[model samples]
Target: MMSSPPAASPQALLRRLLSGVARVFVVPVSADGQLLLHRHESDRHCYWTYPTMQRGTMRTDPATVARRLLREELGAESGVLRLVHVLPAARTHARSAVYAASLDLPAAEILAAREATGTSRRALQGLAVTAETLVALDVRPLAINDLMTTGGIPARTLLALPDLADPASTVNQPG
Candidate 1:
C-alpha cells in the first residue's frame, strides 16, 4: 500500500518547527509613548517587530517565561512589565504573550543588564527603531498595522483572533 505524502507548506513547516515556543512582543515605548521596534531577519516578510520575546529554556509559566525571553531577546533587566494580552495556542503549537514595557536606562545601565543576563550578542544585532520606521519599512504591521488598516479591532488582538485575550480571566485583575 502506498502512503500519502506529508501535507504541510514550507511556511507551515517552519512554523511547526517554531511551534510550542512561547514568545512575547514587547511594545517598548519612548518616554513620549512612541512604540519601539526593530528589524527581524527571520521573518523576512517584514523588516520589523515589537521588542519581542523568545523562548529561553523550555519553561511555560507566563511571567517567568516572559521575563526570561525579554532578557534573552532584548537584554532587559528586571523592570516593570505590563501584560497587554495572552494568546493561547493559536495554530496548534505555540502560545504568545503580548506586553508593553518602558525602559529609561542609559548606555551603562543597558550594558549592565546585558552582562547580567548574558545577552550581549543578541542586542548587537538589533536596532531601536521607532514605530514610524516600521511603517516606512512596511513591516507587515502584525498588530497595530492591522488595526490601522482594518479599522476594526485592535490589530494586536486581531491577528491572534479567536485565541486573543487570556483564556482564564473574565475580569481585569491585578498582577
Candidate 2:
C-alpha cells in the first residue's frame, strides 16, 4: 500500500482551512418575520439551531451548500437563497456565512432527517418561530437588527403571532 502523507501535512492543511470560511448557516425567514430552526428535546426547554452544513471543499460556493442543505435536510425544492453576511462563531471557533431564504408557506413536514440534526419534530415542531419566541432562545437577541434583521420586519407580523414569550405556552403546540 502507498504511504499516507505526513501527519504535519494534515495539520498544516487544517490551519489553512480554518483560516478561511468553514461552514454555511442557512436561515429560512417567513414573510411574517418568523424563522426556521431545529430542536431535539421535546420538553418546554430545548436548544435550537439553524440548518447549518459544512463546506465540502474550500472551492465550493456557499450558496450551493445552503441550497443543498435545504434540499437534502428539509426536502425543500424551491426558494430564493440570498447571501446575508459572514459572522464569527465563538462556539465552534470558526467563521461562517449566513444565508436567508424567503418562505411562501410552511412545509407540511420539516426536518426530513431527525437523525441528522438530532431533533425529533417534537411538541413545537414548527420551525417557523416568531420574533418574541426566537429571542427567548438566548442564542442572540433576535429583536435586534442582526440575526435576520428582525428590526426590519413589519410590526404587524409580531402582532399576528401568539404570545409565546412563555416557553410553556408552546408546550401545547405541535412540533
Candidate 3:
C-alpha cells in the first residue's frame, strides 16, 4: 500500500492557496463615458459588479488575462486594455488584479454579444451607469467604487473614465 503524504502546515497551505488563486476585475468603459457592470441572474447575494474574471494561471500576464476576460465576458475585443491596479493577496481574497479597457462599442452592442456568445458562467446583464448613478445606487463589492475613488490605486489611471467622475455627458443610459 502507498503511504499517505504528510499534512501540509498552515503556512504552506496558505501559500498554496494564494498561489493557486488569481482573479481579475475588469472595468469596461464605453466611448460615451459609461461603466459596465454585470449581474448574474443566479447571484442573489450581490446586485451588480464590474465584470470579474479568474486568471487561468499565475504566469499569465495581467493584460492578457484582462483581454481574455473581455473576450469571454463581453464577446468582443477591440479595446486597449491596461493594468490599472493590483490588489495584493493580503488585501484581496485571491490576489485580484484590476484592469481598465476602453471599448469603442456601446453597452447595447456589448450586451448583445454577451447574449449571443453565452460564454459567462451565468446569464449576465450588463448595465452602463454614470459615476453619480453608480455611487447613488451603492452597488455591492464596494471595492469597485473604492478602486475608482481613493482605493490606493492611481487616480490618473482611472481619471480618463467619465464614470469615475461626476456625471457630465450622458453616454449610454443605464439599463
Model 3, stretches more than 4 Å misplaced? 1-21, 41-46, 56-58, 90-92, 138-140, 150-175
Winner by TM-score: 3
User: Residue pairs in steric clash, candidate 2?
Assistant: 123-174, 123-175, 124-175, 125-175, 126-175
* Candidate 1: residue pairs that collide: 24-53
Q: What RMSD does model 2 have?
A: 14.5
Per-residue CA lDDT of model 1 for 102-129, tens digit only, reads: 4455445555556677764543323334
Give lDDT per model, in order.
0.48, 0.51, 0.60
Lowest summed lDDT window (length 10), candidate 3:
164-173
Clashing pairs in 3: none
lDDT of 2: 0.51
Top-scoring candidate (lDDT): 3
Ranked candidates, highest lDDT first: 3, 2, 1
TM-score of each model, paired residue for residue? 0.46, 0.56, 0.63
